[model samples]
Target: MTRVLLLGGTGDALAIARALPTTHVYSLAGLGRVPGDLACTVRVGGFGGIDGLVRYLRDEHITLVVDATHPYAAQMSRHAFDACALADVPLWAVRRPAWQPQAGDDWREASDWREIVECIAPFHRPLFTLGREALAHLHDIPASQHWTIRCLDAHPGNARASIVDARGPFDLAGERALFDAARIDVVVSKNSGGRATEAKLAVARERGIAVVMLTRPALPDADRIFDDAASARDALQHWLTRP
Candidate 1:
């Protein structure tokens, strides 16, 4: 059985774990909440840094590594690339492609969190999906404006908002319910492109709401880069079979 290390958390990571050929799997997650019935063995929290990860790769005798973390999770991706290079282990990045708006879609692209805040202020009621940590940016906007914020954790910020705590791959129905309940007029989100959070865009389109989309950061130099679970699994199999 070949030992493989999966950098987990994102939906793609979980998907890849299910698709792996072997049972000798080691998964890492940064979030405290672990997915139930994940196919392989799991480890939570950081690996210190590049040096720590390199040591882990050697100590675990990991044959291959898959950088299947969140697209915004740049630090871990960089560490994985560096550590794999140091350990002479094969590395691959599974990144979902960014979502592009079709005609009649009211979309505005923002470069960062600050820009997202600025873009939302003029709207009467904004639905924010920039993550819980970013709720602080909403403070710049007054409480007079209605805002609906969705996140995995409860938001602890000064902004007066109707916070919805939920995990996603949210469906259009759920997103539409939230939007309707909140009377949302605008949708704000990171272009953290994946099917998981795509429902927000669907809801926005259906309601004819404007969307503030954040751009994704660049990826590191990877031996193989794939956009979906099947491709990622095939790449992993190829690497594992290579002499």
Candidate 2:
């Protein structure tokens, strides 16, 4: 069986791993915390850097590499590209299509994270899905303004707004409930487009809430990027079959 190294953590990566065909898969998870029932053998933490990754590929005799890491994780993507080149191993990047605003959607596009903070000031009740790190930026925005922040982890010191500590793959019903409970009128989120957090968009569409969407950061020069798991699996199979 071909040995495959998968750079993962995001839901897209998990999907890819589940779709792989009979390969001996080794998954690299960046977060110290591992998900329940991960389908393959897993390795947590960084591979030091490019040099380290190159050595690992050679030592383990990995035939191919699939980078299905988060879009925000640009550094790992760059390292994967570089290390694969050095090791002469095939590499692929699996990226989901970004969410675009629909007709009648009240969407304001922010160029960066800082711009997202400024854009939310005009709204009375803002629902923030930009993750926990972004809460500090909104500190001066005002506590009485009513903000709802959702994140994977709990924010202990956050006093300005209501925090929802939850993991995602969230559905429309849950999103609607949260928005209704918070009395949210505005939604702010990064364009970190994937099915994992797409319920926010769905809720916003149904409620006609304004969305302050941040654009995606650029990706590295990956071998190829596919929008779905089936296409990614096909690419992986082609790579494995190639002499």
Candidate 3:
């Protein structure tokens, strides 16, 4: 009788989603492409908020919640934690560790946008891999700086910036070419721990350019937590199948 509700968006979430049974639900925020291949029922859009989520849990008879959302999605993770508590359902999460600075990494931690802007003020050409969030501040780009933003989709950036619509799992050689061609002196990125987009960090490290990394936000505690997707998926399947 146990039914799972997976709150997902990132690749890690998708991997976990693939392991779910047909009866379980995989939910998305309607930003990226919905996978046509998932066996589990895909639920697009939000559940309103904490109250709405609680109602959904009760109505759908969801006994457990898996928070496989992005590391930066602190709000949604909090909502899942609260909603599960209200509905008296178990809440589990996949907490991926953040990427740490290596030997040659010239990394600078930024708690917020203000700090990020200040840290990169000395650079003329900066590459941003922080998604569309940076697009909002197009007008705020400093007079001396030019931004090269790489996101999932293309956008017509203003005079101060240009958008590169591309996906990740970027290779070191390619990233090196990008840095060299753009004359990039700095990189602005979220410390989203994964191999997919980590090439930029290596590229920055070798060039000795500074990387202004956004620190991970503190998330609410879960009933159970897994470090990676494979473990979470295995645990869910075993829990569901075990007598």
Candidate 4:
């Protein structure tokens, strides 16, 4: 039987975990509340580094590695690639596609925090949807710029901007209301490309607010890459059954 180790964080990770056979083990970075009940064996927290991961794979006799981490989890993904190669285990990734701009979208593309900070300089009230992990890199942005930041977790009390602790699946009407309330003049976000957090882009276009959009980091090469759970499941079935 093919013993599988799934690196999980997103909904796709959980979905794939549920679909795979009983030999699978699901692991998370334990960044948030240890998510609700999952079907397979669960392990949480970081695996030290590439050395630790390679050791774990060998010790556990894992035959396959599935990377279903969040799009921005480039470090973890790179580690997985290196570790799996060292361990001689096949690896695959499930990467959600990035969002493309539509007509009327007023966007300024940026590659990193420095670029994003520069992009927002002309605007007064800049709303940052870059999440808690990426927020620290923006210290260079002048204190004179009034900022509004949103994340799933609470701010650390030292934050200079107004922070909103919330999760999303945000809609256009609600996002518009949020922008009005915050008096947001410009928006900054990563191009995570999912329906849940996409409302702000539409609202920004409607309001003619400029958006500083950060592109996703380049993905590490994998044996196979699937954008959805069904396709990943089909590929897994074939691999697991192959002679």
**Candidate with the greatest TM-score versus the true structure:** 3
- Which model is ahead, 1 or 3, in terms of lDDT? 3
Off by over 4 Å in 4: 20-22, 134-143, 156-160, 237-243
Best by lDDT: 3
lDDT at position 120, candidate 2: 81
Task: Itemize residue pairs with steric clashes in candidate 3.
Answer: 169-196
For residues 1-243, what per-residue lDDT tens digits would candidate 2 score against the true structure? 478898887777777677554445646655435755655667777788999999999988897788888777778898899999999998888877788888768899888766876788788888888776566754675755777788777775355677788888899888888888889999988787777788888888877889998787788777777886678877776766878
Per-model TM against the reference: 0.88, 0.86, 0.97, 0.89
What does candidate 3's lDDT look like per residue over 1-243, in tens digits?
989999999888999998887999999988878999999999999999999999999999999999999999999999999999999999999999889999999999999989988999888999998888899999898899899999988799988898999877799999999998889999999999988899999888888999999989999999999989989999988999989
In candidate 4, what are the lDDT values of residues 1-243, reduced to their tens digit?
A: 579999997777877887765668889998655655766788898999999999999999999999999899999999999999999999999988998989998889999777876788888888899888446744644676767888888864335477788877798888988899989999999888878899999999888989998988987999999987778877877887899
Of candidates 2 and 1, the better by lDDT = 1
Local distance difference test, per candidate? 0.79, 0.78, 0.92, 0.85
How high a TM-score does candidate 4 get?
0.89
- Report the candidate with higher lDDT, 3 versus 4: 3
Cα lDDT of candidate 4 equals 0.85
Question: Which regions in candidate 1 have their CA more than 4 angstroms from the true location?
Answer: 19-23, 137-141, 155-159, 237-243
Poorest stretch of ten by lDDT in candidate 1: 21-30
